[model samples]
Target: MAKTLEFAYETPQEVKVGDDETTFTLVCKNEGLPVDLTTAKLITVKIGSRDGYLREQPISIDSLSKLPTGQFKFNFDKDTLDNFPTGSYFLEVWVADDQGTSIYPSGNPLNFIVTANIENSSGATITTIAYDDFVKELNKAASTIVKGDKGDKGDKGDKGDKGDKGDTGATGIQGPKGDKGDKGDTGTTGPQGPQGATGPTGPKADKGDKGDTGTVDNAGLISAPAFHSLQTQVNNSAVGTNLITNSNFSSGLDHWKVNPGANSDCKAVVTTDSDGDTCIHITGTGDACGLYFGPVSFNQNQVTTASVLAKGIGTIWWIGLQSRPFSNFGTISTESYSKIGSIMQADSSSDTFCVYFNPVNNVVDIYIKFAKLELGSHATDWCPNSAEILTQSDYAKIKAAIVALGGSLS
Candidate 1:
């Protein structure tokens, strides 16, 4: 195929030695269209000089979705840049796809400079001499010293007289404490007076008559029909909202399928939660017990959030044709229901997406409820399927409304 891959990166790409957390954001296209990065098995950025190679760093798998559309980031840590010296280097993005390996820029590679840090560049040039040369110079200096240096020991002079010794100093004493003062006298107490006489009691009053009971009006309260109407409205609103089919497993794994790779010991069953609500219980021992709901339709570059009311630890993954965005909820309480979710953006080829559930380990027991996969960056309240939300009364009300509006029904 002709050269179709094009790469563009942000500028100010200079880096300092010993620096960490350096990043390069790159946007790629193929034939003037955004390239799907998730399709590649591996993507790496190689840094090298004209002489040879320096270092190569791969993009982190988890953070790929955190970037904007058609963009990928290559992060360099302290260890990678610490080895680089002050010099100019060339970098190329290498992608390994199903077709073959390809490098970006179809022409010359991009240039990036690694400047010297203060700790590495402050000293001047240092010179070193050979050991044999130092030995030869030492021998020549030793030969120049003569044996006539022993005649200076003949002149000894007399010493001067000593002075008189000084007297010893006396010790000092601490001062005495002052005397305490006398205390003052207390005041006298006052005399007590005589008590007054008590007054006479009044007559008792009569009790009043009992009041009548108030009546309760049950007509204004929500009846079975009214409740069914409200519930139908809620479910109808959420009919086509959730991307995943049978997300809550209310139909006992009707639309979910067990992963073929999961261990044979894994088991899934319809169970009830502590609150008497329906849920799916998955359990296994010694291997991954996984299930998935797939082929969920999504728009290009659409952002979606997936959530689950769960008890016990597990990993939730939003699997797309070219991207996998996942989050682990380890702090889920076994004693009560806990909500866990993850937000991800779909790639250009993201029409096919899947919601995958994997237990933290093979030896597992988990209760799952309200499994929701919906469009938008945040999760909303959970609702049942449209078919399951309506009761017989709800259908009757809909027919009545249609009839009153002069609409015909079969």
Candidate 2:
């Protein structure tokens, strides 16, 4: 294919007779081309004795340094031009492709060059071209090529009728649905849907492998991709599989063992709470027994936290989660610091994270909402469990971060 390129010369208009170390550039406007550089041959530059356009090759100057820019640098050092007389000269540059066909810009008559050589015996005085002054003059000259005096302001044309939007293109193929849903409003989430019929129990709780204590992952410096890469791995792992089954309690007690525990004598009932979310209603007489759900499996030492919203129908209640208790299941944690929620982080390796309503009461009737036992030590905003492990927010974050770091989702 033919290529179009804009080229510019960085050469000054004059050179001293013995300027042995002067360097100038021929820049490529686009980086897409190889600039005639190749393993078999180099782009060449030569000087011509006469100034008219050279239909033929000119006298070759010695080979030039192929610059990193892919352009060549023609040098006129003391040795290279020792015998040449001080006079006007023209230059031509050309390169050959693998096919041996030469490629080059149209040869133009080079701009005039004033050479200070021995032939001009008049001792010379140097004139200064301040960088700023040169730039200002250059800008002024450049502006003249593309600008002219503004014509008297033309009257505004009549407003054109709004063009109908181009017909909507046929819908493109539907993309796969986003992997996760958004982490919606974050307050104490109300109860999820009332538990549906308790499904057949899972195999009797198996004594399983204790989860491993995962290494603490840290974010890397934006400058250091290693850190980012490491954190990315960690994030990916965390986002793989969700441990909580029936997180929203939508399937009733499908993955849960909502049995009344020690001294309790009530069955776990699926019902909605004031918040209008499905929840488990545990009601029976027992000083301690309550609905228990889990034997959540995990990798050894993998930290996890269990969360549930709970409140008592009676004065005192023992609401527990992941074998831990959240003192006030419905109130802001800060209001009564003593009335706490959020279980301490623990490794799921040796012990399982369980949720139970073993409140401290004789006839305990408590409502438990959204029992979530997830992999992280902290609970993020709740999103219903499904095919996606991460929430919508999490999905967006990981995708954005990966893209920013020049990565792609698999």
| CA-lDDT, candidates in order | 0.56, 0.46
Residue 406 displacement (Å), model 2:
41
Cα error of candidate 1 at position 359, Å: 5.1
Prediction 1 TM-score vs. true: 0.36
lDDT of 2 by residue, 1-410 (tens): 12212223224433556666765444321122445353425455555554444233321223334355444444565544544445445555555556673534332323223355644334565443455754555454444443334434434434434433333334335446887776545445344444344344334443444444333212222323343444445654763245666767888887666455555466678888666789877776553444455565545443344456656642222223343312122221212111213323344433443544333324556666665555533445565555535778888899999999999986
Estimated TM-score for each candidate: 0.36, 0.32
Error of 2 at 215 (Å): 27
Candidate 2 RMSD to the correct structure: 45.5
What stretches of model 1 exceed 4 Å from their correct place?
Answer: 1-240, 260-262, 286-288, 313-323, 326-330, 348-362, 385-410
- The true-versus-predicted C-alpha distance at residue 149 of model 1, in Å, is 99
